[model samples]
Target: MKSPGIVIVGAGQSAAVAAHALREHGYRGHIAMLGREWHKPYERPPLSKAVLVAAQEPLLDVLAEEAWARSNIELLNGSDVAALDLAQQEVRLANGQTIEYEKCLVATGGEARTLLCCPPYRRRVHYIRTLDDARRLRAALQRRPQVAILGGGFLGLEIAHAALAVGASVTVLERATSLLDRFLPPEVSAWLQSNLCRAGARVLLGTSVSDAFPVETGRMLLATDAGARLEVDEVVVAIGLSPNDALARNAGLEIGPGGGVLVDANCRTSNEHVFACGDCASQQRPGQSQPTRLESWQNANEQARTAAAAMLGASPPKPPVPWFWTDQGAHNIQMLGLPADDLEYVRRGDPTNAKALWIGHRRLVPIHAVAINAGSELRALRPLFDRDQPVQLQDFHLDTLNLRAWAKQQALADAAVPR
Candidate 1:
């Protein structure tokens, strides 16, 4: 006569998408989403880029106010989930209240990792995780603050770009030998570092902070592992993120690499009624060896939609090609899949060329594409990845590649379409 309640935990992008997917699939059951953040769900990408430079429109509303009301999905803000009692189908919140549900989704995403400096200097270190964190960092960058960034990853370089744009002198300390070494190859990392230097920011590789002694006038005398020292007005610690998968672990659910909830291709966890997605969920693709958790806006939305459908007895959507984008300074970096060691990558154009595209190939088969400000063209090549004949470099240079049209012929030639 009535449908059971479906409770979605965490109010981030994935949690919001889960609510929308449940309604889109015609599930008229009771739906509730609880988020720990004080504000309603907002996009986080701009936190490192546009939000730092200027104020913009709100990125809210996975389900707008009226949409939530009309769809009968309860919006519970500031509700921090503490524990889950799977046997009893109840979740205990931080306020000591238990909410009952027939099915639960854990989408509590990750948090920005902080520095391990002196206890008193913790407040001096800034991290950008939420809207409020971004706002605070933006305010601190008002009058050209000398900024010291502690990492050389995408987020760190992004913040460095923003800081440099506002007339701030920036110095980045990266423990690794190259910038974005973990994600990008040496050639790409060199290009990014060159841009950072050209933008009036100093990039220091193989360097780390030993101590941050507070000096007069809100500055810190920083000591480095490489025997260097500098005083900066503000410090940004954008090292990385740690997944928020403790609730799933507490419920005795299987955990994957990097401390994320282990879920299958269908987003089902060890518990039959429990599912997880987004940065908090770790999964292994068919061809991959190690289980990985992707932290991107695309992953958050797509995985949640799939997990919600599976929970509602619907066929899951086809998995995507794992595309992600980053905006740093004035460049738009779009990537399809990550750089793999086994794949031999080829660049369509020279690195000095503005419209260059990098394609990774293994045995002459396309596996990945990395482009700068060439997103539309890069996206068109997705269907042709490892499915068609080896793409010719001359075709890419001459702008004569019609990947979509070529992929259409694949069904006739191979009798199978990639999902």
Candidate 2:
């Protein structure tokens, strides 16, 4: 019998990972990857950091061309899957071409959330969601334009860091009173704000753009809700991302709470043969009450693998402990597990040092850990999360001894690993 083949949509991080995973699992069936972008899949994290500062293009492939060729996975770039015919088990592209598949993976990511702007301001304002967006913004940054980043999230702060490195005057305006309000705790948010301020970027809180009018050829006058007007050469909006679940929803698939395609523990969507992962898929954690759609690069890679395995009739993979990191001008914030506003903070290490760990605990158990410039420590302590037993604070001191060795002495490995 001929294999019905698998069709994966949206050539982003998740799609690329899924393609490689299916091949790695010894699936010899036909595989097709469809993308809306003309360029092949590349890393998105660099689009905000390295890509912005580099003088030349950086090769940002999740999976290299040679590997794809060896794997025999067809890359159909510039083909947007406009609609999915669920009954026929096929997808119709924007160009009116339809392709049949036994199973499909909807890895369509998202677009940057747009802000209201005045006439002539639309073209001048920038939004970074893709490599092309970053390329254009990078070109504009060369002029050392006074850039006003319209959001204070990680992406916006990362861009500000890049702009500051290039000698551009940077001003960040956020709608909320604090930066990264949705994810980071208030203390972390203040720390980030102070760092940006120290890096010579003006950080404003509780302010949002009401309108942006173009008074000159390249300059834009932005009027804020607080009745303040700031004129800048360029404006970049990094407010947030809206999930690209239109295709899934249009196909009568279940949509999750956060505008994501709802999926189960195995990353299987409403349509059994059809799966979803990455930023587009919403999944509920074991201990968590609500469904979550993680937008981090870690989630994208992990979820893709899960979706690929499930499609191959393998048992569901174990859920991963959520981990994400952000690189500012001089600070690298690496966090393990989810951060909650109500969680009590247990400060570890020298508080005076800029590089320190902020561990969050719920009563006795260590629920989350946020480390600054402590990636190694975070990775070492990751196994602790798999254990049901609480990681005691009395075990060792940050003042001396190896944290990794001490952690192992506690027999974290002996603890049952949760799925």
State the C-alpha lDDT per candidate. 0.81, 0.84
lDDT of 1 at 152: 91
Per-prediction TM-score, please? Answer: 0.92, 0.94
Pairs that clash in candidate 1:
none
How high is the lDDT of residue 112 in model 2? 83
In candidate 2, the residue pairs with backbone N, CA or C atoms under 3 Å apart (3 or more residues apart, or in different chains) clash, namely none
Report the C-alpha lDDT of model 1 over 1-419, residue by residue, as the tens digit: 12268988998888887888888889888888889988777778888887888756345456677765666667789999999888988888999988888999999999887666733136556888888888888888886888999989989999999999877889999998888766665567788888889898989999999888788776877899878898888899888899999999999999996689999998999998999999999998745787889999999999999899999889999888888998768888888866677877666655555556777766655667788777776876777653534544435554565645653454235433232
Q: Across residues 1-419, which tens digit of lDDT does each residue of candidate 2 receive? A: 12269999988999989989998899989988899999788899989888989777788998887886677877899998999889988999999989888999999998788876842137668998888888888988998999999999999999999999988999999999898866766667778898899899999899989989888566899999999999999999988888999999999999998789999999999999899999889988865677888999999999999999999998657878899999988788898888765677665564336666766766645668887777887788777666645555654445675788866754444433222
Models, CA RMSD each = 3.3, 2.9
Q: Which stretches of candidate 1 lie over 4 Å from their true place?
A: 1-4, 55-60, 63-69, 118-121, 386-419
Q: Which ten residues in a row have the lowest lDDT in candidate 1?
A: 410-419
Number of the top-ranking candidate, with lDDT as the measure: 2
Error of 2 at 64 (Å): 2.6
